[model samples]
Target: MSNVKNTVIVITGASSGIGAASAIKLASLGGKVVLAARNEEKLKALVAEIRNAGGEASYFVTNVTDKTSLVGLVEFAIKQYGRIDSLVNNAGLMLFSDWKDVVVDDWEKMIDTNIKGYLYAIAAALPQMLEQGHGKILNMSSVAGLHVGGSSGVYSATKFFIRGITESLRKEVGVDSGVQVSMISPGVIDTGWADKVSDAKGREAAKALNEIAITPEQVADAVAYALDQPTNLTINDIVIHPTKQDW
Candidate 1:
């Protein structure tokens, strides 16, 4: 594993879940971290916590859906840290709606935030990474991307796109630019993503299932493993799930 010292990492959705945990873990390992998300208060709190612990950190109010906001985030990181070594595109949403009852608005929101957000982040970071000739991009995917299930058609489709894009980028970039692209597919995570489930039965089921979900910190650890790899090494994909999860 490479030392985290002096590494500059930019993370989206850094206010909570895997993003927040990854920020803290990377900082603790001596990496300078930039936290980007729409929640200003939460981002500030996380930044303060890292600083108090003697780690370098900063916060930028970023809405991943907005391309300009993403551009600003990349610029902020460069201005603050000199160079960005990695980007964790972790912002996403999961809405529980059966295809029969799906609302077009909700479907669009899921597609935009879960899929387009990743693309925008890549679009903003790639130019800088290409110029640097070395970078790592970690994307947050879900097991739903691999398996189709009830009430997750649209959400799973978005994740499937994530998986495809990450793999395609990996091949396109190759080892020439020293850029590594990978995806982490987690199942049954204990994040508050289930809180977005509005259907009464689906909400209850999701809550019960999440009772056995893995902690966000666990996923963060996986991300740290990928980042810690030597420049010559690349982890193409990681699939993580609670041991008890059957599907």
Candidate 2:
């Protein structure tokens, strides 16, 4: 039996990278994927692509950093599919910078999108899932959470926070409720994020680091594997880094 068949799954950051890849993959597996992101154009195109492939999908313009947008996203999914089976929290920011550079603005951006954005989405979705009696939550993190480098202090800290949140959610909610909680951590994915880095030095470093990075689809595969499981079994966490990437 397909664990994702006919299930309604909501994915944040569905406009690009791992989120978009996971949305396509899950939809192909008979999942009704609701794409949520700030980029309406990309989300619409992705939804159209999924539908053209004979997969069920829809788009909802959402700014994960905004609580109201998250609430609306969850509402949109429930309105379209009646219930949410899973949530893929994949939106995040990684503006790497050294401590001496004191890029406080970058730090705040990461905290807002990576940390609070996740919490806001959970706040919007958890209640609905709890009432429905069964659901799954998959948070996207980074290997940086496991080992922080010199320039990724704030970005890594946000992922570490995600790790902590996933554990707490599993223990507090998944222990008894039908809800399941899981996290997928990937390292140095080639998602064009290297060019998006704001700090000049950090951007160059990120580009070099991405030379040994894996593709977003690879991380999406890990996400699928974690979600495609029996209800009685929860794949708690998955760590996926390129074989060439050492430490």
Candidate 3:
């Protein structure tokens, strides 16, 4: 729990953005990373890249929205590394539109990916961590979770769900179960998250905000810091944003 060297960490949403950045960073620190995402090709490529860098890694094609898929991911990680020391629930979708727009499909996608996905991953990983007696659960949330904003009501709600889960789980398992739970809520980051916005207005708004966004690597560095802490220390929550981001 204290060292990253040889620790087996499972990361969902590992295809790109924060997940990919964190995977590369964690692997570089001598952790054995198990990458999972719906994109098998990207996962394979990332695994190859990690190996090329002299780091241990593997991949499992998975959809976090599916409980069975999450279960399979945990099983694959165990098969690859014998045990899991931490899990990074980073798979999420951000679709912004006014409630009046009734972008029901986008709403469902965010709920499934941002909310249900974390629930499924938690259900699958918590038991294994319990059995191991020491583990960490790192969640990726958003600053939106803290405050509602224009055209992002539903997206913000989903992130709020993540915040609630992270906090509740921290209390549920903190120290007593030897499990550490953390939430990293980041502001606008220059990732593909904006591409998921369906409405022109929403996309334009996100684009404008992204003008002062941070990089996924910066968020990955925060993740690395949280995981690098000693066993007795647990970084409960982190809120990171670009210096120019006023809201």
Candidate 4:
């Protein structure tokens, strides 16, 4: 893989899971990482861990659902490091409940956090990328985006929206812009996503599946793969699943 030394990377939801894993991995490779998330303590701890390991890192306590907060995150990166070479839109919500039993508030929360938040992050980063004429946007989608299952309709819809948005943005940016957009769709990642499920049975099922799930670092490696590609190369979509996962 190409060394991204001196590149500035911003990752949302960097307090934990794939976001945190990606930040550490990228920073370890000499990239300057700006971690964004709502959990200030977690973000601080992660920043210290990276810095202690001889990596360049910082933290921005941000709420992805807030447009202004996202803009601030982008601006902070530029002001702190002079440029943003990459953005990892990894903040998301996966609340699962039967369609009939789904609360409207819960549905809205999923839409706002999982879908709108992704869009806001792109909006925050795209302007700078366009001005620079070169950048990479890596969005975290899921296999749920491509398929349907019980109690996952709303969550799946949000991911499907992510895939569609990433594709549309990729085409819109086109060749001259030097702004590449890609989506990573992972199956049964060992994250805390299952904790969001409201249905006990669904939560248990997800936990059971994740028992043999792929590690967050695995997804992080895929993100680095997309980012390390030549400017002319855009990996439109990547779907990664554990060997034991049939779906």
Which numbered prediction scores highest in TM-score against the true structure? Answer: 2
* C-alpha root-mean-square deviation, candidate 1: 1.1
Which has the better lDDT: candidate 2, or candidate 3? Answer: 2
The reply for model 4, stretches above 4 Å from the true place, is 1-3
The TM-score that candidate 3 achieves is: 0.98
Q: Per-residue lDDT tens digits of candidate 2, residues 81-127?
A: 89999999999989988999999999998999999999999999999
Sort by TM-score, best first.
2, 3, 1, 4
TM-score of each: 0.97, 0.99, 0.98, 0.96
Report lDDT (CA) for all predictions.
0.90, 0.93, 0.91, 0.89
Q: How far does residue 114 in candidate 3 sit from its true spot (Å)? A: 0.7
- Model 1 ranges with Cα > 4 A deviation: none
Assess candidate 1 and give its lDDT: 0.90
What is residue 199's positional error in candidate 4, in angstroms?
A: 2.8
lDDT of 1 by residue, 26-49 (tens): 999889999999999999999999
**Tell me, what's the RMSD of every candidate?**
1.1, 0.7, 1.2, 1.3
Query: For model 4, what is the C-alpha lDDT against the true structure?
Result: 0.89
Per-residue alpha-carbon lDDT of candidate 3 for residues 1-247, written as tens digits (9 for 90 to 100): 4378888999999999999999999999999999999888999899999999999999999999899999999999988788899999999888778888899998899899998899999999999999989999999998999989999999899988888988888898975898999889999999877877889999988888888999999999999998888779999889999999877
- Model 1: residue 38 alpha-carbon error in angstroms: 0.7
**Ordering by lDDT:** 2, 3, 1, 4
